[model samples]
Structures are given as structure tokens and as C-alpha cells.
Target: MDQISLALLSVFFLLVSIVWYSWIFKNWTKKLPPGPRGVPILGYLPFLSHNLHIQLTDLARKYGPIYKLWLGTKLCVVISSPSLIKEVVRDHDAVFANHDPTVAGLVATGGVDIVNSPYGPHWRNLRKVFVREMLSNKNLDDSGPLRRYEVRRAVRNLYGKIGTNVDVGELIFITEVNVVLCLIWGGALEGENRDKIGARFREKVAKFVELLGKPNLSDFFPILAKFDFQGIEKEMKGVLPSVDEILNSVISDRMKIMEDSGGEFSSANRRKDFVQILLDLMKQNDIVIGGTDTTATIVEWVMAELLQSPHAMQKAQQELTQVVGLNNIVEESHITKLHYLDAVIRETFRLHPPLPLLIPKMPSKSCTIGGYTVPEGSRVLLNVWTNYKDPQVWENPTEFKPERFLNDDDNGKWDYIGNNFHYLPFGSGRRVCPGIPLAERMVTYLVATLLHSFDWKVPEGVKLDMEEKFGIVMKKSTPLLAVPYQRLPSLDMYE
Candidate 1:
């Protein structure tokens, strides 16, 4: 055949194959949820917005509550309706319990930590250690003194900067990280070393979180993951060593102590801090990142909302004053009685959940949700932010109103347990955040201490910025800068 005839035949075969494949795909995915079309190969990746949560929500508005998108070669289904979310997280919890860890996540956690570990026996064991040993009621209760000490220390630090502008997020981040370290290994590191190590750990963790939030092409196209085109995974690996070094030192010291004590570390004689418990099972980086980052982010968001809404702040302060009194400092014991403060926290969570989309869940097997076929290994994102802001479910959903939670109309109506799908700030079902108990205690205690001790306002000529910077953990685009004035009757209380 002539060159032109050969070329024409090749083109004809290519067009024929494309038509055949398109037909097969249309028929195969007939039951799949509808979504926007995308260009070849790249799929909808090129069209994605930086704020994926809001973008997904906007897509939901167009394509209905449950919609699918092809991100490169990956199939992602975002479910925004409460009912559809329940179908995925509740009804088919087991099938969809596995996490689809990104390259950064895998590198940071080493694919063994509870957050990103595949749903299986190993994951179950890790979770058990986390829940029963680290975050059990007994453990948290035991760590109360440490938590209180850290919060008090933070308040004292703030006392020195009274009337000076402070980065609320940074302050809370430092305090929460310290609190978490103390809870994990209170007596292990002390004095200057503790501060130095804590600051370094925070620096590394900040990088880790930022990297985790960054868009990586490797995640969309697994075939390209080996190349590390964005270098996100490489950067994450670099950051992990510093974190691992600190953890290793702590672990080695603890091991030496165990050896010095002649196996008494295993006996009832040894203290049962989180580190002691984790040493029995495995070294965990997830708990450090997950516990500290999420708690601090929530505290920051709550504080930002409070500073912006003076009435809400005053109400929370009033509740704190009434519960703990002006003369005494806020304590964990006072957390339960501060119902209005609880409402404010709930409201804050409603408005700005730290993990807006929650951790991505991957199905271990093919499952059907909302009468649509969810192929095995497909990524499932429950749009908790959209659910929280849905006008159909909430009255004036955009308005920051804590009173909505204060009513006694229904017991346990709004909670983080993931029972109420519409209000799943901590997510739901079997893969629900295992850190709920500890997170609740940390956030409430931190907020109460800060508010009860001082009245905070945005610095002069500064407007409180509620704009969110979307990441693995959603945070304020601008760090909250506020000056705090002493609210307590006695300055001695701060000391």
C-alpha cells in the first residue's frame, strides 16, 4: 500500500478503537453516578480547584449529592448528602474502611500508622492500642494533670504578652504539641531539651502537613508515583527523618530505662503513658501528627470564630466564668459544665471542620452506594463541609449560631461520634477518628483556659479573617492575630 493509504488505515483503526472503548465504558459505567466530562488521560485533574472541598461541593450542586470524577486514571466519588454518606460510611463501612494514602502520607507514616494503614488485622491492632491504651478514659484521666500543667504553662506564657498581639494558631499549636508530648512521655524529655525538641518536631510536622496538603500528580496517576514528579514524597521523606530521630531518641531512652529496670517496664510497676503503651506495640508517628495538628487546628478555628463574633465570645466567657468562677483557672473538670462553650465549639466545628473532607476512604471490594456502583479501590470522599452547610438541613447555615446546639429538643442530636451524619465533624462509621475522646478534652480545655483567663480581640486596624486555607487540615488563610486582656479577677491565678 502507498504511504497515504497506510496512514489513513492507521487513523481509521485508532478512531474505531476509541469508539469501541467509549461504548464499553458508557455501558459499563451506566450505573455509576453522573459527573462532569473530562479530557483524555488527565481526566478532571486539570479542572480541579485548589480548595477541593468547596470545589467538590460546587460539583455536588451541579451533579446532585453523589457524583463521580475521574482524576487522572483514579476514580473518585464525592458524596455530599447525609443519606449517601451514611450509605458509604455506615451501611458499607467494612467494605469502604480502607484508606487511600497519598504518597506523602505513606512516606510520613511509613504505611503502618493507624491513620493510613489498610483496614485489616494490623490496622485493628493499631487502633486498639490507640483507643484502649493511649486514648482510653483511664489514660486520659491519668494525663489530666499533665494536660493541665501544659495549659497553665501556656497561659503563663501568654500572661507575659498581655495586650501584645499573639498568633493564636501558633500559641495553640505549641501548647497542644507540648500537651501531646507530655501525655505520650511526660518525664522522658525535660527543660531546654524538651523545648528544643518540641520546636523542631513542630517545624517538621508543619512541613509534613503542608506537603500532605499539596497536590501531587503521583496521587492521581499511580503510574507516575515512582518518579515523584512533584517531589512531595521526597520532601516528606526528608522531613520524616528529623521527626523519626526525635522519636527514636525517646524510644531508645525508654528502652534503656526498660533494660535498666530489668523488664519492669512490662510490669504494672512502670508508668502507663502513651509512649509506654505504644512501645509495647509499635512506634507511632500518626498519633503525634494526628492528635496535635487536628486539636490545635480546631482550637484555632474556634478562637478565630469567637474573636470575630464578640457576642459568642462573651457568651462562652460568661459560661466559663459561671462554671469555673473568676478567681479560679479553667480545668478539665469544668469542661463538661460549660455547655455554652461546648455549643460554641460544636458551632465552630460545624462551620470549619479541620479535616473538611475527612480522610479519603477506599473500598476494599466493589460496593453499591446510592444505587450506584462504586468499583473496588475507588476513592470515596464524604463531603462533611457541604453536609454541614446544606441549607435544607440547617437554618441559615452560613450564620455562626451556637444556640442551635444549646436546645434540649433532642438528646445527642449534634455530636462528633459520627452518629448524626449531618454533623459528622470527626467523621463516621468503623473508620471514624479514634482520637475523638482525647481531641474533645484537648480542644475544650485549651479554649476554656484561653478564654477564661483573657478576653481576646483582633489587633487594632486588623479585621478577623475567616478565610480558610484548605489543606489536609483546613486552617485560617491568615493566622489569627489577637491581643488578649486579663479577664480573671486575680493575676495570681495565671501564675
Candidate 2:
């Protein structure tokens, strides 16, 4: 070997050691919030979990409101308190509105959809279309019949399973899929028809979600992000084709529906599902990825909690029976009268928010949070699970008490949205779930109808397992097994 080559190698090694020690002992030690100690360069990546929501919530209890976590080369600061969450996600909303360009987001939104779009004119337009056509109140009202029809179909299925063990997760997943499909394609899946439009939509949506939140080394290290070292691109490559096929077929079908009617579908007198409006957008601004995942997650969590909390379930059922009697189907009109059911749904959202660390919020420029200086592009996470469960904000925070929401003084004040930030399941800000109203309707109607028409109980030997398995959303660790009995004969629920 040459003498100069050895000399240059020695110089490089010395500089690398100096930088590594500087990040740990000098630069990061004082600036970053308190967190577990870790080795050089790698940091705390090994200490993290696949279900980061649960992991972060535990850490927040130990470390306080703001805590630091390192993923590969970058430092991520998580905010769990409501005051900081409001200050960051609202007051400085625009500053932290940009996405972190993670592989999960890129794959989920097809890298161009509204949910993943960079903060700019394109994102603004996409949000407008989502709110105006896809998620507008007028459209929700127009699709009320479709929702009612789906709810009836679900009730029939539940009734048939009376006295027999059933996997409620599979039942609810299929039911929610049909609800989304009817809204997406204007139809439902019938028995033995495996290749139906609804089935196709579910298949595509499932593949997209399964791949979206999977970990990727590229996300943590930008220099390797484009290279796709962890085969994230391969997984996405397999998912995108199915997603495109489903959307494209729906696009074509909507064109036919319009032609047959000799006019464009009206929000007042139209199916007005997601796909129909998506086709009309001209540019196909964003994939409807969030629609399926977010909705499915909400449904799953709502059902899981209902199955676990029998008293809460019975209270909802009692209200549902009174509001929607036997022989009658639950309608949009019934949603308002089922107050207990609404409270149950709200409790589910509070305890198990779909996106634990809502789409990572990045600062547009350097800023100060909790007395610490954060640089531009530093990734920030709103640890919603922590905020929702904070004992200081909620009474008996750990208990699943739906009655806490019932007003005691008869003043009729619903404290769901108030000053203390007790609930932010849909988040709060310019980027709040645009699908909030639609989600609320589906959850309310489905819960009210299911509880109204059937009595659900866990199997003989099996206790309702409340352990959570985290995905992009928190889900039940084990699928719920319940025997749904026909509504008590005197209840006349299905009359």
C-alpha cells in the first residue's frame, strides 16, 4: 500500500469519530429533550417498536410532554400534551404542515395524492374537491339510502349468526367494505360472487393498506430513500397496479352511469360516491387511499371497544332499541336520537385514535417548542394517544365510561370539542380529517343498528381480549368472537 493512502484513511476515521462524539456529548445532549441513552450513530432506533403508538405513549408517561427519539440519522421529537399539540398543530399549523416524505406516506397516497401532496396549490385544490364533492354534507345526505341499505344487509347477516360463534372482525371488515364499496362503486357484494365490483375494491384497498405502513430503512435515511434498500419499492410496485385497476374500472363505470342517465350525477339525486367524484376531478389529484384505511380503522376500533365493554354496549343497545324499534331499519334520521350510541363512538375514537402519530408534521422553518429549538425540516409527531388519555384532562381516563359524556345538569352541553382538548380523534387544524362527517355517520348508524337488532356476547370459554395490535391504526390483538342473538322477541328490533 501507498504511504499517502494510509495517511488519508487515518484522517477520515479521526473526523468521523469527532462528529459522532459531538452529536451525542455536545450537540444533541443539551438541545434535545430527555430520552433513553443509546449508542453512537445508531441512537434509539433499536428501542422502538412495530406498534409505535403504544411505545410512544409509554415513553411520554416517563419522559413528560415532549420527548426525543432517533430513527437512524435523524432525531424525531414527539409532542403529547394538548397545549403543545394545539400550539404546533394549530397556531403554527402552516409551519408544520409539510409531510416527512416517508415510505409509508409515499406508498399510501401513490406519492401524488392529496394526503401526501406537498403543501402547495395542488394540495389546496385537492382538499377543496375532497370537502366539496367527496365529503360534502349534501353528498352524505344524497347517499343516505345507500348507507341504510348496507346497514340492513349487515343486520341480516348478524341475525343469521345468532347463537353461533362468529368472528366479528371479519364480519365488520366485510360490512365496512360493502359500505365503502357502495359509496365507491354504487353496489354491494352478494353471496358466492367472488369477483364482484365490491370484492375488487376490498382487495385493492387491503393490499394498499397492508403495504403502506410497513417499515422501510429508506424512510429513516434520505440518502438511501430513492434506492429502496428495504424493498419498499417492490412491495409498492405490487400494490399500485391493483389500486389503479379498481379506480380505473370505477371510472369507466361512472361514465356509463352518466351516459345512461343522460347527465352528470347530481349531489341531490345521484349515487355521488367517492369514485364518481374522483373521476370528475380531471387530474385524478389524489388516490382515495385515506378513505378506505381511515374508515376501516374507525369501524374496527369502534366494534372492538363495544365488544369489550359490555355495560357500555348494553347502554348503547338500550338507546338504539328505543330510537330504532323492531321491524324498522336504522336511518340517517335515527342517528340524532341515539345519543348513547354517539357517546360510545366518541369514546372509541378517544381511546383508539386511528392515526396515533398523525401524518408527521414538519416545520417550514426553525422554531421553538417546549423551550427547545427545533430546526426546519425536523420531523414532529403529535402523540394523540397520550393526549387523549392524559389523566389531568379526563376523569377516570383509563376506564371505558361512556356515561361520563352525558350532561348531568340538563344544560345540554356536549363537551366533545372544548377548551381543554379532551378529544382530538379527528385531529384539530387545517389538516383535520376531511372525512370526519362521513366517518361519524358510518360509525353511528352501524353501531346503533347492530346493537338495536342483536345481542352480542363473547363465547363460552373466551373472554373479550382487549389487547391492541398496532398498525397505522390500533386494532384488536385477537379477532373478537361473539354470539349475536336475535333481538329479544319483545324488543321487536327487526320488525
Q: Name the best candidate (by TM-score).
A: 1
Tens digits of per-residue lDDT, candidate 2, 300-408, equal 6677677777778877777776777666767889888877777777777777777777777778887778887666766788887887677776788877777766666
Candidate 1 local lDDT, residue 436: 93
Kindly give the stretch of ten consecutive residues in candidate 1 with the minimal lDDT sum.
263-272
* Candidate 2: stretches off by over 4 Å: 1-30, 188-204, 260-269, 280-289, 408-420, 488-495
Deviation (Å) of 11 in candidate 2: 14
Error of 2 at 187 (Å): 4.0
Q: Write the per-residue lDDT of candidate 1 for residues 142-170, one digit (tens) a residue.
A: 77888888888888889999999999888
> What is the lDDT for 271 in model 1?
53
Query: How does model 1 fare in lDDT?
Result: 0.84
Tell me the RMSD of model 2 versus the true structure. 4.4
Query: Roughly what TM-score does model 2 have, to 2 decimal places?
Result: 0.86
